[model samples]
Target: MTTAVLALQGAFAEHESRLKELGETVIELRDSDDCALAFDRLILPGGESTVQSKLLKERGMDTLLRRKIEEGMPTFGTCAGMILLAQHVDNGQGGDTQSGALATFPACVRRNAYGRQLGSFHTVDTFADMQVPMTFIRAPYLDSVEDSVSVLSRVDGNIVAARWKNQLVTAFHPEVDSDTSVHEYFLRM
Candidate 1:
């Protein structure tokens, strides 16, 4: 199956490498034309959410992407990607950014809830019974998930991973690690 990884920004290359390592055909989605390509799944890598969202809309691919996800395209979002897919974003304190979000997943996310890039860290955790290393760079944690959401994994008391329908998201970057289990899980979904 072909998987399209959003290449507009962030660690798209790293995700591409991991997906290829798993023996899957990968496509780097950039514009509307790339969005039109036939693919079984999509990956939104960790990066600057505001920048990615702005680019998506400025390039006129935002609506198309939202349609694809709504139509059941299995998607995996990491870090900033999770923010893009979230229905609401609590910008920490008590404010929200309404524009530019894809709003596919029924959840409220808090951007940079773990602080800035300097607050970045790495940790090993159990995901689906398999030990995996997660890298968090300016991560955005899920503050609240709707009833339709399934909590996948958590670090400390914060929700880090979850799934809603065909969409799966993580507050950490699994692609930055050597392990391919997280990508494998998305492929399975």
Candidate 2:
């Protein structure tokens, strides 16, 4: 199956490399036109959520992506991508709707919920078949989600990974390491 990674900004290249290792061809997505015309599955990589959202808006991908997701196209979001998919975002930064998100998942999210970049580190979690080390950088801790969401992994009692329908999100960077199950799972969908 062919998968596309939104290459508007961020660690999209890393995601591209990992998916290649799984023997799947990837399309580096650009613009709403590309999002609209590209493959069935898409993965939005981690980056500055506001910046990425602005880029998506500028490129006209915002509407296209939302439409695709509603049409049942499988999507996987990491870090900032996860932030973008939230139904609500913390109003901590003066309640700017621009800081708001796509409302893809039924919930709220606070950017940098984990802390600063220096606070980033690795953790081995039990959710995967084997212990997998995940890298969290300026990550967002998932506070609440609807019943449709299933907790896939956690760290220190906080949910770090979860799934809703064909959509999956992780606060940590699995692509930083050598795991393909996550990407493979999306492919299967």
Please list the residue runs of candidate 1 whose C-alpha ends up more than 4 Å from where it truly belongs after superposition. 97-100
Compared with the true structure, all predictions reach lDDT values of 0.91, 0.80
TM-scores, in order shown? 0.96, 0.92
Worst 10 residues of 1 by lDDT: 92-101
Residues 113-185, candidate 1: write the lDDT tens digits: 9998799999998776788998999898998899989998889889999999999999999999999999999
lDDT value, residue 182 of candidate 1: 96
Q: Name the top TM-score candidate.
A: 1
Candidate 1 RMSD computed on C-alpha atoms after optimal superposition onto the true structure: 1.2
Residue 158 Cα positional deviation in candidate 2, in Å, after optimal superposition: 0.7
- TM-score for predicted model 1 compared with the true structure: 0.96
Question: Lowest-scoring 10 consecutive residues by lDDT in candidate 2?
Answer: 94-103
* Candidate 1 global CA lDDT score: 0.91
- Among residues 3 or more apart in sequence or in different chains, the pairs in candidate 1 whose N, CA or C atoms overlap within 3 Å are none
